[model samples]
Target chain A: MPYVNVKITNEGATPTQKAEVIAGITELLQRVLGKNPATTVVVIEEVDTDNWGIGGEPVTLRRRRGL
Target chain B: MPYVNVKITNEGATPTQKAEVIAGITELLQRVLGKNPATTVVVIEEVDTDNWGIGGEPVTLRRRRGL
Candidate 1:
């Protein structure tokens, strides 16, 4: 069993995209570690860009710079 | 910052395996969200079979059942 928590800056990701990501991560665990996908839990949390930072700069600023 | 926490059942995972998982997650964030890897934090937690629960049963019991 695995509990995977992924926090991504809330830029712009469709629900479909997030669902695909969750499925991909679950598949990764099953294929690489032989983990059962039935018991795996994947939670995706979208953090506000203001709360997310990169290299000490807020993600909002980075996004504005096209980074 | 993107904090990715992965909790895997501590049945059998080498240091090398954990490293690969961490690296893969970091790359995923960078590629998907354009988040800088330098600010991404990936922590792999080894969950004891006794503590991890799945399908309303402890992982230890589930493992014994080959689930």
Candidate 2:
């Protein structure tokens, strides 16, 4: 089984966007890796800005600093 | 950087439990794979029962059937 986990910032993505992402990843894996969509698991996670870090600082701080 | 994604059924896991999971996975990767915890990313995604599937059936249906 092919498992794909996508992590994105929690910036108000809708359910339709999430569903599209799941379908796209599944299709990509099926076309390239020959994985079965039935067994392929795609999970989308939206991380809060404070929890996601970049360059030794949280995304929230980075955004505040205009980075 | 080692990125670890954990998927679990949405069964009311508390924030403390989630924190523990992140720490545990980071430590495990550091000990076993010599990965840097500073650069390691651990994300936890909890899937709803209706969205999660097993044996070609949704988890909600399976749970109802006592499977």
Candidate 3:
């Protein structure tokens, strides 16, 4: 079975929101990519602002310095 | 930084196509989600026809039995 790993960082997402996103992805894969929902596994990883980056720069630092 | 994992099954996809998809995803995350491309990780899994399924059914068996 095809394995799809999806990680999205959303500081404001609640547990329910995370679950919804996973379900949505599963549905999308089944309909769009024709993947088997049974075999498809979705993994969601939430990263804190400190651990994330943008344009090869640390997001936390940028936000803190107002850069 | 946001991590988005995309899994697509394409029996006809080449290695180059896979790389292209990864790049596209990275770019999309940067533009759409304002994620850092440096920290974004994309993993693509290629499932064999026999190993994949659809609609809670085994895709391989369906294709084989011509169902």
Q: Number of the top candidate by TM-score?
A: 1
TM-score of 2: 0.56
* Candidate 3 lDDT, B1-67, residue by residue in tens: 4556564544666677566656765665555456678877776656666656776776677777885
Worst 10 residues of 3 chain A by lDDT: A1-10
lDDT of 3 by residue, A1-67 (tens): 4455666655566676656656665665555455577866767666777666676776677877885
Clashing pairs in 3: A1-B51, A5-B5, A6-B5, A7-B3, A36-B53
Candidate achieving higher DockQ, 1 or 3: 1
lDDT of 2 at A24: 94
User: What tens digits encode model 2's per-residue C-alpha lDDT throughout B26-64?
Assistant: 777779988887787766667899999989989999999
How does chain A of every candidate compare to the true chain A by TM-score?
A: 0.89, 0.90, 0.74
lDDT of 1 by residue, B1-67 (tens): 5788999878889888777777777776676566678878888888888997766888789778876
lDDT of 1 at B24: 75
Provide chain B TM-scores across all predictions. Answer: 0.90, 0.91, 0.73
Which prediction has more favorable TM-score, 1 or 2?
1
Comparing to the true complex, what docking class would candidate 2 get? incorrect
